[model samples]
Target: MQVSEFHLTAYSTALFSTWIFIEELGLLFDAGDGLSAGLLQKARKVKYVFVSHADRDHLAGLLQFQQLNGRADGPLIHYPADSGSFPALEAFSQRFDPHIRGEAWRGIRSGDALPIRDRITVDALRNDHITAPVEWAKSLSYRVWHKKWKLRREYLDLPGSEIKDLIAQRGRAAVSEEVATLMVGYSGDTPVEDYGRWDGAKLLIHEATFVRKEDQDRARNNRHSSLEEVLRMAAEIKIDQLVLSHFSSRYSAEEIDTTIRRYGREFRVTCPVYRLLPGQIHRDVLREEPVWSL
Candidate 1:
């Protein structure tokens, strides 16, 4: 079986993906430039697209992606329905409606499930921990699923239970189930508290803007997670593998690695820590190896 993978790109000091494979189909998250275009072409071979957030770094190359791929019947563009926060997405929808033809852009929120393929599910999570306005909070994060692969019997229906609980208690809901062989978490500017809610992710793809503890104040003020914060989250969740990215240009590759190693030692966790530098290309070797048995 050909292993599915996740590709990363740089845009606005953040990490973006050209495409991610769930089941046999490809889901395009955020699009960037540089190596992103090449990855997007590779992703087009698969079937669907899912835009996680509306930030420029996340959606910069989306228009170009649509233009290059042209139009073919597939899933409707899945994104947050909040028009106020995602103005660019709304404009893109109107401007490119002719060439890249799509069904209505389905608005999603925390708890919504989007079926990507048979048994594969994508559950939307709110990006509220950012301290941004509610309108801007529409930036959706996701948790994918493959029911048959779940080891715990209760885990199969946990998403629905969680969503129902959230809605009944919170009075609002937007979660869905899409078939997913892997559970990857994308934090488009999420804060530390948000990390607590994300449990059992095999690979946690998160942002780490600063490398030093001195920058902790700045990271908090900016409402972004620092390298330490990312590591802390990884330790808290006990994730099998942690991919730390969205680094600040101030730190060199060596510096980032050193910082990660220093903090990683304290946590005593064996999960490998990886960084995403500008223009860096990361292939999913883990998919080929299948190290995590759970």
Candidate 2:
């Protein structure tokens, strides 16, 4: 319903680990190290796991997670179609464990919107984190949408009884149409590129792998975002609330928080900004006080 209601628990560190668990949707975005241990028994609730890329830091926990939670029903996993790592992992996992079902592993590409729950779908959109041919889907960003049928504008003034009668006579489609709301978005391991994808989202979990521009610029092969760049994008875009993750270990928590507060003021961003500190597992991230909101 709202970003805060997602019950998000996450942990992220640049080149080390990154994962986000949204309890309400039973969705885990990127299965990095320690995911199973961090969530414990709650990991069983994961109905969908979306891997962002082939980077080991982003998907190292898949084997252990599959071992612990795999079943016929699913913890259905979707990864970039072009990334060979997922298929390799699936092979080794099935061979080693021999019991974990490999049936639900799926290869996905950009623009694939797979349903995770009734009226809710997760869309995989390609990001520029890993470069390849235009057709290759190596890295991704994801969005969760909640779709529901609402009364058409023409039927908005009708009485409840009349609406029910109309529905019975003409069918629901005659008076109602589906409307979708962008509930949550996860920008998995990416540099700041387009701000429009996350516009009007209820919440966004984005990666900010560096605090300094020089460090960000140095990593030319596999791209990453600087804290300033992300904040700048946030200022330009329309988003309700933001959660920044995947900060480099080089920065102390104090420096990260201070920079956020400073840049937040510089950018004049109004939305509440939450963050996952480099080495900590942020539990109920929305419940904690944000680093900046003005």
Candidate 3:
């Protein structure tokens, strides 16, 4: 449906911390520094966390988050299977908080899909954010799908009584087909390569770490997307809304917004676009006035 339905509360900056809480789904993307302090009581609602990578900025707040919200059936933490940092941190969290124990940690790889809540599934996709082998699970992006069963096309025109009879004769599975709608797409930290990666996603939360292409290219140690690259792709894709985050501390809010508004129009991006300004917590991002739209 709409992002407001998810009630996204988030805080993100490129080099410091990043975390997005989807209130409706009980889902948290990333666990960067200040997650507990920023969300406070709201943090208790997070039952599942999907970490994109092992970068310190992406998962620096895991200990505090788990300590406060964890119970015997504690929250589940999912991370890239090949990322070494999470295992160590998991062990430390267990030893550090013996009383508040049982934070289940799962290492997931690309193409794996996990059901986080009823009728909702989160699927992982590998991205080129980190250089590694093809099978390595070093970095990832995620897609959340909301699934429902609809009457099969062949049965849609039939009478309701007949459909019920058919269902009684056969089964619900035989009468209906499963359909999934892309509710949200998350690009944790990645360069813009696949223009259609987020196509049909209703709400896309992506990282735009650099305002300039040159600046992003200069940092060869890791990969990141610039504002223009993301907006240009947004223009070409079919996302209902876009939320830009993980902005660099180097750019002022004015600079970030100005560039977003400028390229957004230049690329003819039609979707309502919102941004999480660096170092600030955005409560209900889509409810806020959009920075760009046509």
Candidate 4:
């Protein structure tokens, strides 16, 4: 599936709440405040939810979300393995919503892959947001991959009839191989590092909490990325579309847009770049006019 085909809705403001919903996949990244209120009926359609960290701003909405959509069969919630907060929340949710049984709470770590669809998988990657011990898993990013098939190199040049015959004789697996394309990458509140991890994705949704290096002091604990850092990373990567979120409330829309344009020019970034303004719930984020369009 194409990343462009998904309808992405998001509301992200640093320290308040941050969430992104992919309507097509029924997938959600982070369940921050107003998640249930913002998504409303669409919240029920979510079959998979991934929480990046235990930060209150990242998971405060899970209570309302679970109250509305928790079931005994689906809508699994995934979180960092070493985060005790998720288990506590799950327990509280169980007690608060005694009738909901289908909600499965799972803890995952870096390199874990969970299939959300028959051919689509979400893989977790450790991020540098949390400063826990080496063995502790507290923060993560995710990448979505779509399975595709192609004729094996050895059979690529074969005639149609020959390929058909081979397929008939040896089965499809023998004639073709399965390939996966990185459809989307979501950097949930992470500093811009390891550009290779997100490169080549069709869509990259990352955080730009600070627009300037001087404003880094605004974050007291977890490290955050600056707009300049993100732009520099974007310039060096091979992403098709970029969606930036989790901007601090200190900056106005005009200032954020202007900075994005400035960095786009400085970095010679050609990809369309979209940003979620503070306190606003962006609907069909990719469909909206990008702040810096080539």
Candidate 5:
């Protein structure tokens, strides 16, 4: 379970669990190895379960997840109504036991908000530029806000019911005064345009698929962001810390470091940045980690 400043805590029990928070509630983002009985045991605390995208890497844990969780009775499973080849609803039904198939699944578009609690709401934004059919590829960027407090936090969710609300209500998603901090933004396999128009994201968990200049066009064609684009987005959004992740297995850590430095020099932003690799660990993960500078 690799945890970083950008992503919420991830638990590697019988199943793989990675999540992000809207308020205090746990929003399960990716549940890998859904068949692992341990996966459900670990996810007992999840209030909202979201399948970020429909790609096999993103949806790999759904079967085990449905097995352990046993349907919509526990946490609400939100996903996109139509995910390229695999319509989210049909996939859920096919993957899970028939008993759990129709559990509380909500379909979402862009610009909609899903209420996690009385005080917290998750708002969704669209990434129109990315054309990948994977759920994470067509990722739904989010803004989590505390209604009473007026504080806003941003994250990324795949197209689901929660996201539909966020897309439906654009511009109205503002943070309240009571919100003390804003955390990082998740780029679940997003493209360059996904980071555009971001105003005040403190941290960015973006993907750096290719490091070499020769591979730049390939990365762009795949709708994955390059190291250069990550830096540019951070500089433009003024993120406090940027954690580049989802690297192709091809690159070594040293190679990634060289690429980051190369792009960092070009962008010249003061934000601290890091890269996330497999098997990394962090303690006391929160779905909604604070983003305010202490």
Candidate 6:
């Protein structure tokens, strides 16, 4: 769960609420109800927020969040460009909290990249969770990338003096090229459609709202992923850690964990697997003992 130094905290429950706060990046993935209450003063550190879709369970706490921590210089919120609910809510937030201003509310589409830091950027990828066509922008997933440079393989054995001299003559860019590493991938809410969507991610946080194929029928009215489908997909991908959330309250914690253990063994999964149980706030979720450890 620890990708370099980022600490992730979250609360998720299907049809009720869901949100994740990343401490190192000052970023929040969603703004479900009780966000302000759960994070308290720590919520002030959030400088950027990405909302996945227009579902009420995903955005019910925006008003409280804005009122509590919104300022002229912090907490920019982004959402799908075609989600009309956001614009209307933005206008309502402005009028409801007349004293709050300068908080940027932006409309973003797939393929857009927003820099969270000088060397870190968050990229959005469209996902099929809102029943919108591929041309429409109604839902999204996010990936956080860290940009860095390392000595070229050919120059690794070069003398320090020569390397410094080469840098003076040709600049550091001549010897090294920038590379981006996928630190974390957030699959907001979607069906298990692409196994490669989160491949090679150091950590992946995904939603598994149902436990079985039979239960998936109940979720058919809305787009969602089932636990079996998600784990099956994870077994095929290259991820260091997997955190599943947004499970329905219908299943008990024991039921969810038991099912996860069975799947982990059946799929021969080798990475640590974690789950966020219903009606609970998980702090430093990665640090907690995974439901099924490697």
Candidate 2 achieves a global lDDT of 0.90
- Please give, for residues 1-294, the per-residue lDDT of candidate 3 as tens digits: 455566889999998999999998889999999999999999988989999999899999999998898876758999999999999998888788987767799999999999987888999999999999989999999999989899988898999999999999999999999999889999999988787779999999999999877888888776899898899899998999999999999999999999999998798999999999998999888789999988
Per-residue lDDT tens digits for candidate 2, residues 129-173, read 887887899999999999989999998998999999999999999
Across residues 7-41, which tens digit of lDDT does each residue of candidate 4 receive? 99899999999999999899999999999999989
In model 1, the Cα lDDT at residue 11 comes to 34
- Please list the residue runs of candidate 6 whose C-alpha ends up more than 4 Å from where it truly belongs after superposition: 1-5
- Expressed as tens digits, the lDDT of each residue in 78-190 for candidate 1 is 77766354556657666766656553456777778878767767777777534557654366667666555322344346667775775577554233333344466666556
Candidate 6 lDDT, 50-147, residue by residue in tens: 99998998999899999989898978999999999999999999888899978689999999999989889999999988787887789999999888
Candidate lDDT (C-alpha), each:
0.58, 0.90, 0.91, 0.91, 0.54, 0.90
Model 2 scores a TM of: 0.96
- Per-residue lDDT for 1-294 in model 5, tens only? 112332344422111333333223566654444223433354556667665555555556555565556554556766555566336544556655676633566656566677776765666666643464545435565555443433244524344565556556763353223542334355555666744445455556566666675676854557666777777777676666665655665677677777777677777756666665433332333333322112
Error of 5 at 3 (Å): 14
Clash pairs (backbone) in predicted model 2 = none
Model 6 TM-score is 0.96
Q: TM-score of every model?
A: 0.73, 0.96, 0.96, 0.96, 0.67, 0.96
Q: Candidate 4: which stretches are off by over 4 Å?
A: 217-222
Q: What is the alpha-carbon lDDT of model 6 when measured against the actual structure?
A: 0.90
